[model samples]
Target: MSDDELRELVHRVDLRIERLDARFDALEKRMASVEGRIESLERTMTTRFEGLETRINTKASNWVVSLWGATLAVLIPLLTLWW
Candidate 1:
């Protein structure tokens, strides 16, 4: 209604806006920290899974080689006895 009252209202609104901005900035910082932690966890899990896959592949190869060796050892003796 008066110029002084209008000015006071504007000042109060400005203060509220500043406070809201500060809160948003703080929330943004916290979100960034949480995102960083999540990325780090994903990298660690990826490394662990890759290691497990390598171990499984190595074991499978070893089993295949052992199976072939055993089959040949048995076949050779039978062939020699028959001949």
Candidate 2:
């Protein structure tokens, strides 16, 4: 090919490479944004799960206390009647 044609080809290739680089940079920025969003969602979910667990544990503890109080009340009355 003539020198002029070769130069034109090289210039076209350079422009294509520059466009590809810009696209890659933009894609990297978008990926970072998605990652940040995912991390935020994970933190929110973790906090909600912790709150649910605390509620469940509190309910279970209340049930146990009530059961113990009822048992003692019944047992004490029976013992006094026997004595």
Candidate 3:
């Protein structure tokens, strides 16, 4: 093959490589954006779950305390009668 023809082929290959590199860079930017959004969503979900857990714990504790109070109110009177 002629030197000119070989040079032309090499130049074409270089252009193709540059285009591929640009495409890769664009893809990387898009992936980074998606990763950032996912992280934000995860943080929001975690905060919401933590708040829900706190509410559930508070409600359960209140229920237990109320139940204990009611049980004692009934048991104490019965025990006194037996005594």
Candidate 4:
């Protein structure tokens, strides 16, 4: 190819390279935003699970105590009458 044609080709290639670089930069920014959102979602779900676990544990203990109280209330009276 002539020198002028070669120079034109190089110029077009350089322009294409610049456009590709810009696209890569934009993709990196989008990925960073997505990563931040994922981290926030993870933290929110973790908090919800921890709270649910605490409530379940509290309810289980409360039911156990209530059942024991009720059993005693019924048994003591029956035993006294039998004696």
Candidate 5:
């Protein structure tokens, strides 16, 4: 091929490479954005789950206290009557 033809070919290849690079950069930005959103969602879910666990624990503690109190209330009077 002539030198001029070779130069033209090189220029076309360079243009293609630049276009590919730009496309890759755009894709990378999109991926970063998606990753950020996923992380945010994960944090929100974790917070909600923790709150649920705390509420359950509080309810269980209250139930335990109430059951013991009721048992004592019933048993104490019976023991006093028997004695």
Candidate 6:
């Protein structure tokens, strides 16, 4: 090929590469935004799960207390009557 043709071909390749680079940069920005959104969602879910766990623990404790109180009430009367 002539030197002038080779030079033109190189120029076209450089322009294509520049366009590709700009597209890749835009894609990277979009990916970062998506990652940020995912992280925010994860944090929100974690907070909600923690709140649910706390409620469950509170309910379990209340049930345990009620069961113990009922058992004591029944045993105390039985023991008094027997004595």
Q: Report the Cα lDDT for candidate 4.
A: 1.00
List the candidate 3 regions with Cα displacement exceeding 4 Å: none
lDDT of 5 at 69: 100
lDDT of each: 1.00, 1.00, 1.00, 1.00, 1.00, 1.00
Candidate 5 structure quality by residue, lDDT tens digits, 1-83: 99999999999999999999999999999999999999999999999999999999999999999999999999999999999
Off by over 4 Å in 2: none
Candidate 6, residues 1-83: lDDT per residue as tens digits?
99999999999999999999999999999999999999999999999999999999999999999999999999999999999
Clashes of each: 0, 0, 0, 0, 0, 0
- Candidate that would win on TM-score: 4
Tell me the alpha-carbon RMSD of every candidate.
Answer: 1.4, 1.4, 1.5, 1.0, 1.4, 1.4
lDDT of 3 by residue, 1-83 (tens): 99999999999999999999999999999999999999999999999999999999999999999999999999999999999
Which pairs clash in the backbone of model 3? none
Model 2 worst lDDT run, 10 consecutive residues: 73-82
TM-score of 2: 0.86
Write model 1 residue lDDT over 1-83, tens digit each, in one string.
Answer: 89999999999999999999999999999999999999999999999999999999999999999999999999999999999
**lDDT value, residue 82 of candidate 2:** 95
Per-residue C-alpha lDDT of model 4 across residues 22-82, encoded as one tens digit per residue: 9999999999999999999999999999999999999999999999999999999999999
Candidate 3 clash total? 0
C-alpha lDDT (0 to 100) for residue 58 of candidate 2: 100
- In candidate 4, the residue pairs with backbone N, CA or C atoms under 3 Å apart (3 or more residues apart, or in different chains) clash, namely none
